[model samples]
Target chain A: MKAACVENGLVLVRELPDPEPGKGQALVRTHSCGLCASDAHFISGGQNVIDLSRKMGGPYAALHYERAFVPGHEFVGEVLDYGPDSRRSVKTGRRVTSVPIMRQGGTHAVVGFSHECPGGCGELMLLDEDFLLEIPEGLPDDHAAMIEPLAVGLEHARRGRPEKGDAALVLGCGAIGLGVIAGLAMMGVGPIVAADFYADRRDLALKAGAHIAIDPRETDPYGPLPDFGGRRVNLIYENVGVPGMLQRIVEAAPFDGRIVMGGYCMEQEALFVFAAQNKRLNIQFAGGEEPQDMDLALRSIADGRLDVTPWLGGRVGLGGVADAIANLSGPGTPVRTVVDPRLL
Target chain B: MKAACVENGLVLVRELPDPEPGKGQALVRTHSCGLCASDAHFISGGQNVIDLSRKMGGPYAALHYERAFVPGHEFVGEVLDYGPDSRRSVKTGRRVTSVPIMRQGGTHAVVGFSHECPGGCGELMLLDEDFLLEIPEGLPDDHAAMIEPLAVGLEHARRGRPEKGDAALVLGCGAIGLGVIAGLAMMGVGPIVAADFYADRRDLALKAGAHIAIDPRETDPYGPLPDFGGRRVNLIYENVGVPGMLQRIVEAAPFDGRIVMGGYCMEQEALFVFAAQNKRLNIQFAGGEEPQDMDLALRSIADGRLDVTPWLGGRVGLGGVADAIANLSGPGTPVRTVVDPRLL
Candidate 1:
């Protein structure tokens, strides 16, 4: 069992041969993983149009260029064995925290996310023992390998149903825009801000709370915007899919605004549609992330209303998965780094 | 008080001197008016870049050539007079309706749509009677000249929340795309279809309740769309604003779809961001009309939900405003027609 592969434009640390679980599955084993800038934009063809209508076993994009597979899908695995009639009772090993949105021989899903269909990192992940969750003996396996990017910044702040104290923004500081400004400052929202043409992802989006951190190549993301005091963000979340970030978040929204998006840019460029129709904008996009946003994000990380430890920077070992893809293909690295896969 | 003036592109009727009401205002008097294609797209410059975000209004982009100014704004008037403490009142000749959203005495409220904002219309229409809406007396000045495209298809089916039986699609068969299939068939939505490239606006959108029209100059509006009875169109609406109809309503949506957009087109298009991120579209855009969507569209046309009499056809005064703007400027003029600005 060794794994960590990619091959051709290289990554490899391979081995293989290990299979087991069947009826309803549950094999698992990793215990740590998370690299995402969408796995360095799908190994750098800048997100080569994925959406194989959910094909499971393959180094997708037509055999990840003629073979070599395994890359990682955000994890914290454990199980080790299950199978037969499985209504879910993983036992051979226990201590879980999975999701790699399975398909490569099934289970431990949560890769790109799911409503009920995917997850399970690498080094073997056959989950379906009800998509395993278990991990709470006082949370820590590096915070369950950071609950899949804080469940993708709690599914992009649960699409602007934000209230209790609103104000947010977070354009693109990577790792899901600093996990959506640490899940909109743990759902209470605040001066948030975050943008990023990159000043080290705006100093790690001001240690993940972001009370300000601009730099759209230093100012002028269509002027103004960056305030916070007299709050005027009512949520924007867009993780830079850069089509001029949909006309700069509809010219930095506010008047009845919402946005959401969640990066993966390709281009269609501008769209003001009269400033998203005179600021009566809603613009949603990041859909599908259920289990009720991971059970209200593990009850907002056990009631501290989330913290995602300032986007935790370093943690390697899957034989440094090719030095975590050359420190996440440098743009000044450091955004969300974490991976163990039992140290390859 | 005469009016009818597009100058140089001719259509004269001149005179002038009447406009009174001031301070919060109210003068009204037009009584029935509807000649929009945004006034033949501002006498055919086709809403010239909404004259730079003024959401269209003004005598612009060259041609006004000397003596011109008095374009219409979609009327159905009456109040007849008021000036003091005027914040609106159902007095002196009552029956009202005005949305002429225009401001910028951008050179004397260019006459029609009774300039609701600018010096707010003249030869008399000072109205801000906090945006008037009383049209009731047995509804028919051709259904109060369809309260401005039925309050813009009731604000595009209330910003396309469309559900109670959705199967909409209504692209564009003029008169604001069959008044958005008569307000998505008064919200009981059904097999509505109605594409149009014009065979008399697809026979006036199959006489308005359009259960299928198509025609896109014979077909293929990015194919696949036709069937509404095996269910498809979970709402399209677009109202033909020309520049690639928001990329053919995102290559014909359906997978969590809803387009809406009211249309006016000018160049600024390209939107497929991964097929609107795997068909999760919402898109919306009405562009104007929101006084509680003309008071729930005059209480859904005084509660019978709505009926534009098979998209009316003819009825004029003010001396058939230049042969009703040359028979509603070509191809199929029977989609809607109304004018009696008190016969000028």
Candidate 2:
């Protein structure tokens, strides 16, 4: 099996030995895997300038606790084999997507994902039968690969409790930001304003059903996004954790507005506080996407409640690696990218 | 009548002509008045250091608009006379306490507190018919003088909705802090922990029904205050808007705890924002005592539900001019001070 491996400051496709199904586990043959900004955090000398202290919780327990570990958790695959004692929740050859979060760190999973002990991302993966949610009959592989991130957006939307007729502002049109916009749209929460600093991301936000795409680079988004609400936006889905970004969103929020912070903090430069005091805001944190949240996200996709297609800016295989990472990390990357591991 | 007027860095007890009742107003002969810390802001020139260009609304409005305006606004007095055409709502000769906050800048007020539309501290204050609350019989004039500042505590307690069985921390034992503790005690909110820099202030807070007095200058308060709630204080009545005081309260607050900012924000500070995020804090800016809120405070006092005796640290008069201001500004000046205009 060929998989993307991080070795000596490089993320390269390499042939790796296949893994076997353990107790309550299923062997999953990879189909597609998305390169997540989070994955960039785990790989030292890889790409992103991460602090290395705030590593995300995942299925690879020992590796998560170790110095060196394989990266990439956002992926889709077909169940190839399973322990005889595994539940009927999963079937061999069934296409599915699974969440990457783990309680004690993903030590049990190697390939696909596991709802059982914990899970991980590697050449060959072991998944607990319960973690796999079958992809709908006709959904494309690229769309299926997006389930994990969509769950993040879904969590924020659920926490925000956005109702129909509620205006929303999603700060940062990064991959997670796009998911928030799409999820909020599903609830009929609108006049949605998506804010970002990059032109390409702003354009992607519009395609993702944001009624207004505010590019801070061109105009002051602080005053513009809230004009639709007759005050500030009623709900702000904060997917960017820059210091001052929260204050801006707070000021741009209406009285008694709800702000769900769904971003992984750190890295952002500007910060402010007084703006929040003046608005009397209600803020809640929405951390890593849980499996149950991912389940609902997949269900929304299946029911057409959420439309993430517009945020799918590009698709690639392992061969198009550098461009995808660069685009995702550079000045302006579109909302999302789909990577097909099988194409390699 | 004599009023101590501050001019040219000099405070003098001058023979000022007695004020007369004007239309829609009443002349109140002051019996007792509380010297608030805000007066110290100007007396010590601590306020003269900053640029007032971006000052926010309220009592501070005059500081931005006019210079050397007459300052005292908190007092208990007998209504000497109601202006001609005084409505049935207000009767002359009724012993009452009035909050000095009135509308507009550079305008006349029914109360002699023309500084903030004429607060209640002058020898004879003309008050808007709207600002008066009937003082309860048998309540000491010194105690009645504090109802205005105490109303500050009552207003925040109302906004915080600190119910019975909730933990509360009254930070900064100014008149506002004593008021906060008293109000919380009436609401059955406890076990109240009072945090202040001064021993006298902290002791006064305890006497005002705070379960414990944690002086920050003597020891770290976080450990004990949080344990009072068996987790964290459910309500924090913040009367001191120091740079990091808000942050400390936020970090020590229980999940979803409420922080009612009972003090004034003379300037913007970064501490409020940083702690707000990590704690997911909710801060309500309780501006000065409102008319209705003042009534509630007086009623509470009349019913013996609140007490401010411990804060009435000293009593002086128009002639004790320099001493009154200095006492109110010091670290060991007891808690609250009262001024008798007759002393002039």
Point to the candidate with the largest TM-score: 2
For candidate 2, write residues B1-344 as lDDT tens digits: 56776554456566556666656677777788777776654454424322231232222323532243345767888888877887736567778777674434453232332433334445777777666788878888887887788887777777776776677777888878888787777777768888887778777888778888887777555454544534456677878754455555655665457777766554444432322433445566564566877887777777776656666678887777567776565576756777887665
TM-score of 1: 0.38
Candidate 2 per-residue lDDT over residues A1-344, each given as its tens digit: 55555554456666665656666667777676666664553343222122221232123322332222345566677888887776757667788777653322333333322223222234456555667778877887667777888887777777677877677878888778888887777677768888887778887777767888877667655454444645346777877754466555654565556678776553432222333443445566564566777887788767776566765667776666546655566564545665666665
C-alpha RMSD of candidate 1: 18.5
Cα deviation at B312, candidate 1, in Å, is: 6.1
Report the lDDT of model 1 for residue A121.
34
Against the hidden true structure, what lDDT does model 1 obtain? 0.62
* TM agreement with the true structure for every prediction: 0.38, 0.73
Candidate 1, residue A32: the lDDT equals 70
Docking class of 2: incorrect
